[model samples]
Target: SRGRGFGRGRDRFFSSDYYPYPHRPGYPWAPTLSREDEVRMLKSEADALKRSQKEIERRLGELEKEE
Candidate 1:
């Protein structure tokens, strides 16, 4: 049937748009760690990055002032 074919084609197109990673053995679909661990790790990394960025900006300002 023409209508059935079009419906299948539309479903296929929409399904293709939502591409998911291929499932593999021993792979988790989501984070396995507790929320606290995740938040702590993220915050630690973010704070370190922020400190590094501030240091870079301070050095740049010093260079500009010297020029």
Candidate 2:
């Protein structure tokens, strides 16, 4: 029967902002940045992550040597 679990309909799907569909008409559906800008941003983030990982590894090495 049409209770709390059955036949709730499609209204629930579009209620959240995280839904895949656009919330309103004429909204920009794609990234505004150019391909080069996106690539540069990603590369910078990756480099920062790599540097942090290297620092962690170095600290671990020092701790192991002390033990």
Which model scores highest in TM-score?
2
Minimal lDDT window, size 10, model 2: 1-10
After superposition, candidate 2 runs with Cα above 4 Å error: 1-31
Question: Model 1 residue 19 lDDT?
Answer: 41
Deviation from truth (RMSD, Å), model 2: 7.6
Give me the displacement of residue 40 in model 1, in angstroms: 0.4
Question: Native-vs-model 1 lDDT?
Answer: 0.74
> Which segments of model 1 are wrong by more than 4 Å?
1-31
lDDT of 2 by residue, 17-45 (tens): 34455545565688688999999999999
Tens-place lDDT per residue, model 1, 1-66, is: 333235555443345243455742464588587999999999999999999999999999999999
- Per-candidate TM-scores read 0.50, 0.52
Q: What CA RMSD would you report for each candidate?
A: 10.2, 7.6
